[model samples]
Target: MILKTYRWSFVVTAVGLVLAALYGLSAHLGIFQAIALVLILSVLEISLSFDNAVVNATILERMSDFWRKIFLSVGIIIAVFGMRLIFPIVLVSVTAGLGPIEVVQLALKGGNPEDPGTYGYELNQAHPTIAAFGGMFLLMLFLNFIFGEKEHHWLGPVERALEKVGKLEYVQVIVAGAVLLVVAETFATDHGRTVLASGLAGVVTYLLVNGLGELFNVEEHLDHGEHPEGAEAEASGSEGRKGPTGAAKATGKAAFFLFLYLEVLDASFSFDGVIGAFAITSDPVIIAIGLGVGAMYIRSMTVHLVEEGTLAQYPYLENGALWAIGALATILLLSIEIHIPEVVTGLIGLAFIVASLISSIRYNRAHPEAAHVETEATAQAG
Candidate 1:
């Protein structure tokens, strides 16, 4: 089912070099090098992002069809350019006087590894801090998703509060103001202000896009056909379409918040990749090319997961995503205070996600009957 829809993308991507040389955007990278970098990084990023894709699918499953399309196109843009391209430059500029353009030039020049200062910057020197920050940050997020009980605010107290606030004309403005204040205080460092600014911009973007979308009733177009209660029951007794109007709208809200949260998560994830890529060479061009390609694959994978309902089919993927989030969060904090290697943190996270995916697949194959039972129960609730 998934393959049928995105088959063209897959096929064109498989041709690889021909496509990259034709469409690759980086100015500094050679044509052949760009092709090779895109192919390599795309595969790696896709593989690593499977868990993330699955998690995104769960939330997106409930979104209206129109919003899903927008999410796919816009979300990918944000992921590759916002996180991969712009983020590394932000990091380098803050910590050192290195301009992003200069870094890319250095990366393209390419120097010997043993001769440390030849490129004037080494991604390796930055990895330890990236790892330290990424690891701890992801750990905290994992715990929050798995053990931290969410209050289903829309269903309970949160809903009540929102209802009360909704009557106020300035509620949204107040919230936006508060968010800006918090951002200002949190990202006060000379070097990190850019990251903070970018993050804040993302938040504002999400709110405006989604809030206006909701106000204009964009999702109303996606309402499914209604059937007479008894007639519909006779035609489809077992399978039921869930997530009605209110639920779908609520899910849209959730997606907006989730996107905002994940951008921050993506920034943290990039910290290690950006710095680590430099270790390979201080050439910002290579780092950008490699990471940009990887990010493209990640974006593609995220859309695939959303389209396929992977998370609903395999719940354990959520657990893996939770862990990945935690690991990145940890890396964020550690980068400021200590140093750790990106390789170590990335490997640990890779292992957990792979194991969880394997386990989920195995369990489903072995106990198809049990899976059916659970699906039936959920259907009945809907």
Candidate 2:
């Protein structure tokens, strides 16, 4: 049944894997090596992005069908072509002071370990800026979420602490700014200027994108379809709300900004995937095709989670995903000083997700009545 919903994703996966194999053959990496590279990178992308899909679904559920169509169509194209392919090439060109053709030549030198112009090494050289930007953008997201007023508290004590602190204006910004400042002053000294600028750019970008989204939100009280009845109203209580929300007008400037916000959010998530792909192979073609395939699945998963009312059913799932984002954000920042294995990153996020899934199961079993009520509420909201 789940497979039926993901029929398109499967189709994409099949086509993508085939393309990966073909690219491998043409590159002379052997069909087996190419397939292996693609598969490893696919698993890498998928594992890192489970939290991303859940986060996206929360926003996607509130979007109108028209905009959702835009997301499902144009959104994937940007994810595949822009982030997976163009962005990496552009990054190398600009940062390495090499022309686009030279970058391509270096990328094509996949197995030449001795080449100083190796795509992976140049990207690694650029990591401080990349990590700074991605880290701060994602950290803002995590801060907004953790500091937001919510009816549910998965980690009671920790969340309660955040709730109290969130009442203060701009606490999230202050905290994020302080962290950036300290990191810039300390571990990132080598690229202090660049890191500081990139980190601030990230913060400012979040404020503009998310602030514009809230500024023009037409349906301030509209919850994403998965929200339980009275949850927002109860949380709203009076003139109060924080954190990024999906509910907005379907057309005009509101939809455009909302779409932009999602695109930015998508790019932030892709940073890790793009950088991490270097760990496997320096073949730009293989990385692009494999990660592109993985990205398609995430897009499809977002739609499935929304339509199936999965978030409403597993209430803490969102919390778990956010926790993963928080971890990712921190890891990205810390990665400047030390190397973190991709396996470790995947494991940390997966652990949170599994724990939350277990908690949600227990929650449903313990509160069978609440489950029925929420199910009905979700149907009505739809």
Candidate 3:
């Protein structure tokens, strides 16, 4: 069953290896060396992205099977090509005023020899803008989760206090805005305008995507005539009478928005991995193949988590992932002024996840009733 569920992951891994080997041969890199590099990159990507998988599973569990399939299939393509390859190339081309062909040539040629104008070099130069955008988006994500009202709390008192404060309208947005302004002022003095613009763009993107998703969800609920017990239903039954076809259509629409949100979330997570890849190699092709392999595994892990109902079993896991996201966002913003090692980022996230898992296990042992309640909730949600 495990293999059947993750067959696509295995297939992608196989194809990625074959492509990596071919690319290495074409580039005159030894086959073994290329394979080794791919392995290393794959491990690195998985290590950095385990929290990503946990967070993704939380959302994926709510999606339909059709959408989940699309995430595993088409989503992988976007993750690999759009993020691992095209994104870097486009960033360089646009920022450096180089044509697509020239950018490609520069990428293939690796770092610049005489001037710091190669694709990788130019891409690195654009890191501040990328960090601002991704950092803001991730910050919003973390804030929304922590500030929102939730029944289950990993850090009971702290979460309860935050949830109370979350009663303020748009508290997450307000906090995120304040953080962006503070970071831009303190750290982005040299490129304050650019950072501010990018951060605002990030906030806008998050709001637009999340708003659309909620709109679709509300529409779906209306179509189903589902409302709270005390709330009155819409008088016009036609809106809810569309039947199965309407329900399917509504689901598809909601799924599309969910897919978009997931893609953007993945992109935000990829900023670090993509930038960090440069430390391993300047060759764009190698970076794509290696990181692509790792991305595939992350997708596989997401499906695995959803299929296993891991989150339901370990209730605090999602909280852990969100906390890690908070840390990562802080690091991304801080990176503008100070150098933070990628390993440090990865370890911080891992620490949160591990701690949450241990806390969950202990909680379950102490309160078996909570486990039973979680199982029932999982069943209903499924």
Q: lDDT of candidate 1 vs native?
A: 0.51
Residues 186-280 of candidate 1 have per-residue lDDT tens digits of 53243244434443554455455445545433343233332323234334432333332113322354456555545555555555566555444
Error of 3 at 345 (Å): 0.7
lDDT of 3: 0.83
Candidate 3 stretches greater than 4 Å from native: 112-115, 228-250, 376-382
TM-score of predicted structure 2:
0.90
On residues 1-382, what C-alpha lDDT tens digit does candidate 3 reach at each position?
6887778878877888888888889889878788788878888888888999999887776567778889998999999999999998898887788899998998998874224877777988888888999999999999999889774799999999999999999999999999999888977898788889999999999999988986886777566665411123233343422211122222567778988999999999999988887778778888898888899889989988877678888878889999999999999988877778889999999999999999999989998998887776555434
lDDT (C-alpha, whole model) for all candidates: 0.51, 0.80, 0.83
Question: By TM-score, how accurate is candidate 1?
Answer: 0.59
**Cα distance off (Å), candidate 3, residue 249:** 12
Off by over 4 Å in 1: 3-34, 98-137, 149-254, 279-282, 327-344, 361-367, 374-382
* lDDT, model 1, position 172: 46
Clashes of 2: 0
Worst 10 residues of 1 by lDDT: 241-250
Looking at candidate 3, the ten consecutive residues that score lowest on lDDT are 241-250
Candidate number that wins on lDDT, 1 or 2: 2
